[model samples]
Target chain A: MGRTSDARERILTAARTLMLSRGYSALGVAEICAAAGVPKGSFYYFFASKEELALAVVEEHWAGQRAEWTRALAGDVPPLRRLRRLYESTEAELRAGRESCGTVTGCLLGNLALELSTRTESVRERLREIFDEQVALVAETVAEARARGEVTVADTGAAARALVAQLEGRVLFAKLYDDPGRLDALWADSLALLGAEESQGAV
Target chain B: MGRTSDARERILTAARTLMLSRGYSALGVAEICAAAGVPKGSFYYFFASKEELALAVVEEHWAGQRAEWTRALAGDVPPLRRLRRLYESTEAELRAGRESCGTVTGCLLGNLALELSTRTESVRERLREIFDEQVALVAETVAEARARGEVTVADTGAAARALVAQLEGRVLFAKLYDDPGRLDALWADSLALLGAEESQGAV
Candidate 1:
């Protein structure tokens, strides 16, 4: 069972790499299998179809993001600080990825949402839930900030959506231009979008 | 020469439809030719390669957007009003498209930027230029709004970027969630981001 689980993990890891660099539609099951170093039979044993494997990949990716969100954001720090840290860490990761990949990879969920959202209903629904979960996490932090008198969030829901959208949009620009500066400029702007302090470490 | 141009236009039109419904990476040259009702030789005669044809499609699409932007946003009206009209018209188009396509197709450039930005440098550069051009147009409007006392834009460039990102982000969500309401909510949020009045037609 342990060996089986390892094979599954390898398949997923390879799919994430290939899908992130190329796209969901460009890569096939055979390529994913080759990249994973797993036999095609094992690939089928793990997942029903390419779409199912992609769904599993999305789930695994979201679980990792959920863990990071809980760690970096749901801390005892100030709400805005946690949010800023989240964006900062995301930018750092994008920078690191650029060094190896020669370009920013942007967000996997966002890239898939753009490419596969309309093409597959199951994937679209899964992505929708992931986005909702992520937005709710941000909204919760925002509501906390408002409760602590740190920010004036007229509508926490809307503010969270705006911030998340800003993050995604900035990532898209950063990758497209091959410049992370495009993302750095958005940190203060995102706080301002929520009526939070535009300066650093402002509680 | 006229017939050559007609074949070129038809090929581009077909590529746009297929790419928007499917994606840039999924569609093949033969399918594009079949959809356009043009022969393979005509495709090569009109364009050197599939990538070249995709570039032409992007240029032609941007021209249509430029025409719409100039008509809806470049008028002598109040800057904020022009912006509102632009969003309104865009929403109208999205709604119309949804009625026909069963989902929001999203902005063509934005969709391509997400899917092809990392895979191809030429497409990424073309997209970067398109984004820059669009942002400049929005920045000019923000500056005008500031000059006319319609909105207080502290950093017109940043505000324009935020607005553009917000639009793209909202489109991503709208497509993923299969809900245009997600995009409709951004209208007031975008105005608020610029510190503009949320009232109707606040000239």
Candidate 2:
């Protein structure tokens, strides 16, 4: 069962890579199978259709982000410091032009929110919930900041959405310019807006 | 001659609308012609190929954006206010559920940047110029804010890129979440960063 499940996981990962490079519409199931080294016949045993496979792929991506953020941000570091560290690591890779998932992932769910949301409420609803959860997590940090008086966040909900918006924007810039400097600038401006004492920390 | 040329312009508009709604890859020439009510022959007469048409559509979109920004973001109002007004107006329209162009138009240019930059230098170079132009324009505005002492910009170039990055992200947000509130939240954070007094325009 473990070996079989590994095949399923590998197939989903291949789909993710292809979608990141070629986009959702251009990615094909056969391509995933080839990349994953899984037989075409085996894919249906694990997933129903290309869309279902794509959904699984999206779920996997979202889970990875949440887990990563949870670990980095919820660790012993201060809330503000954690946010800075996360963005700082992103800045280093972008500046170095290393292989990274800067911003353009566009949210697998957010991507679906655009392409699939109106047509399929179930998927759309899933996306909405994911966004809500991520925002809530960020909001918890903001709430902490508010308590500490590190910054004046009159609206925690609005602040969380704003951070998401900023991060989302950075992704587009990173992808659009193919030069990560675009995102580095966003990192600085975000830190500045949050009234952070350090600008050099992000880069 | 003007009437015939006007029809050509009409064709370009239709292509842009389709690109924004459906994205560049998914939109077909026939579909654009149908939307424009322009004959297929007319489209080919005005443009060499679908890729060529994509370039033109993106170019026209940028032109309109420059004009819109100049008109909407200019005035006696403070720099921060003017820009936020521009953003807020866009937000109001999106919240009302209008298929506005700036959000997605899938940025035929950005779509090209993401998909074809490595494979097609001709496409990449042209799009690069557009992105640079966008960055420069925002830098100029940051200089304006700096002149007024309304904001302190240590790196005008970075600030410019971040500003545009924010807009690009807001566009994706509009597509992903289909919500304008997200954009407004971004606006609020940006204005705050620009040193806008919270008392005057607090969201």
- For residues A44-147, write the lDDT of model 1, one tens digit per residue: 99999999998999999999889988887976888778988888788887888888777888889999998998798899989888888889999998888898
Model 2: residue B97 alpha-carbon error in angstroms: 6.4
Candidate 1 residues lying further than 4 Å off, grouped into runs, are A199-203, B199-203
User: What digit string (tens of lDDT, one per residue) describes model 1 on residues B39-90?
Assistant: 9999988889878987998999999888888788876777788887777777
TM-score against native, each model:
0.95, 0.82
Tens digits of per-residue lDDT, candidate 2, B1-203, equal 88779878888988876655655556688888888888899888888988888778767877876686676567667666666666776566455445444442323444456554434456667777888886776677667777877776677777766776666656555656665555656666666556555543333
Model 1 CAPRI rating? medium
Please report how far candidate 2 places residue A86 from its true position, in Å.
1.8
**lDDT, candidate 2, A64-148, per-residue tens:** 8788678767747667777766666556544543355433343344445545543444565677788888778878887786677
